[model samples]
Target: MKILITGGTGLIGRRLTLLLQKKGHQVVYLSRKKENIKDVIVYKWDISAGYIEPEALENIDYIVHLAGAGIADKRWTEERKQEIIDSRIQPIVLLKKYLQEKNNSIKGFISASGISCYGTDTGEARLDEHSLFGDDFLAYCCKLWEEETRNFTPARRTASIRTGVVLSREGGALPKMMLPVKWGVGSSFGDGRQWMSWIHIDDICQLYLQCIEDENITGPFNAVAPAPIRNAAFVATAAKVLKRPFWAPAVPAFVLKLLLGEMSAVLLGGNYIINKRMAEELSFNYQYPELETALQDLLK
Candidate 1:
């Protein structure tokens, strides 16, 4: 199979590309810059101008859309929020237009969504794919992201993965969480009872692969592990795995709010999301279902 990936240089995209290549599938990248990328044939795409290199779509069997700006990369000013949505929606609009115009045999389209679709805070309620979407800015962003995928015509199969907090040593939240712990000043945010749905880096990559390979799998699927941990337990476990002292008081909510503004909701609030479709419908096996096992693999 020949696959084309957007945001192919990102954390998840980079690992997924290697996995597909190791399995003997041809991988190509649709990047903003065609230069400086080695070992892969990169095709340039400019989302702002609604342009995609015509040859990039040639002979491509599958496409994984992971091309979105980092949601937490900046303060959620009105302008930054618009960029977050545009970064995700514009790519789909461009690709959908091209897919409609081009005569290609693209079998599947898999795109990235976030668990934040459920909301910043669900307290202890367990959420599945069919649950009501949250009424916050984050949920609004994910809703728009997933809605655009429905119009990807001509693709036989389309799946939108609502991914959880990916625990990776190389990037994402794990390293930042590990940083303060390594300094013995690690602490949970808020009161520390917020439920965090998390997945190991490898498990998430395999989930994406499953969506790509399994024609029976379509629609929205949660990419979280079966077990969800509280924020306090998550930090304590990380400290234990790193052999560091966990003795700091929880960070006060007011301080976080003052520091991060609207972005503070992500750290101070969380939801309990379930991988019901992945576990029951697909019978997927996770490499790291438990937080301790996941941390051990990444930290120790």
Candidate 2:
């Protein structure tokens, strides 16, 4: 299978590309910078103006859209919020338009979505496909992101993966969290009881592969581990793995609010998202099922 990926240079995209290649599938990357690489094609595009070189879509069997501004990149000023929203929406719109104009025979369209759509704070109720959208900025961003994908008229199949907090050693939330914990300053956020749904980076890549091969899977499937852990549990597990102290009291919510501003909602808020559909449909096995085990592997 031939796959084209946007944001192919990103954390998830970079890893996913390597996985697909190792499995003997062809991978093409869409990026602004041109670089020399083996066994992969590079197509350049300007995302802001919505222009992708016409040749980029040729003979592409699948599309994995992962381009977006990092939500936690900066304080969520109104302007930064708009950039986060546009960075996701515009790329999909451009690709949709390109697909429509070219009338390509693309087999599957897999785009990135997030569990944040369910809400910032979901308490103990495990969120699934039927969960209600959270009335928050992150929720609004994810809602629009999924809606854009729905507008595409691809020739074969379409899927939007509502991913969880990915556990990767290279980047994302894990490293930042580990830094403080390794220094013995780590503690839980807010009440330390909010649920956090997460997945191993390896499993996340495999879920995309499952989407490519399984025609039965579609719509918004939660790409998370089967077992969701509370924030306090996650902190305890991390402390155990680091051989650090977990006795620090939970960080006050007001302190987080003062530090993260509107973005603090992400730290203070969380969801107990379930990968019910992914498991039932694909029978996918997770490489890391428990928080402790996943943390151990990552910490190593």
Candidate whose lDDT is highest: 1
Per-residue accuracy of model 2 over 74-187 as CA lDDT, tens digit each: 999999999999999998888888888777668888999999998777778877888888888889999999988877676477889998999999899999878778988778
Give the Å shift of residue 282 in candidate 1.
Answer: 0.8
Give the poorly placed runs of model 2, Cα more than 4 Å off: none
* lDDT per residue as tens, model 1, 1-300: 899999999999999988998888888999998666556789999988889998899988899999999988999899999999999999988888888877555899999999999898889898999899999998999999888886678688789999999989889988988889999988999999999999999999999998888888899999999999999999999998888999999999999999999999999989899998998899998889889998899987
The regions of model 1 sitting more than 4 angstroms off are none
Best by TM-score: 1
lDDT of every predicted structure (CA atoms): 0.90, 0.87
- 10 residues in a row with least lDDT, candidate 2: 149-158
TM-score of each: 0.98, 0.96
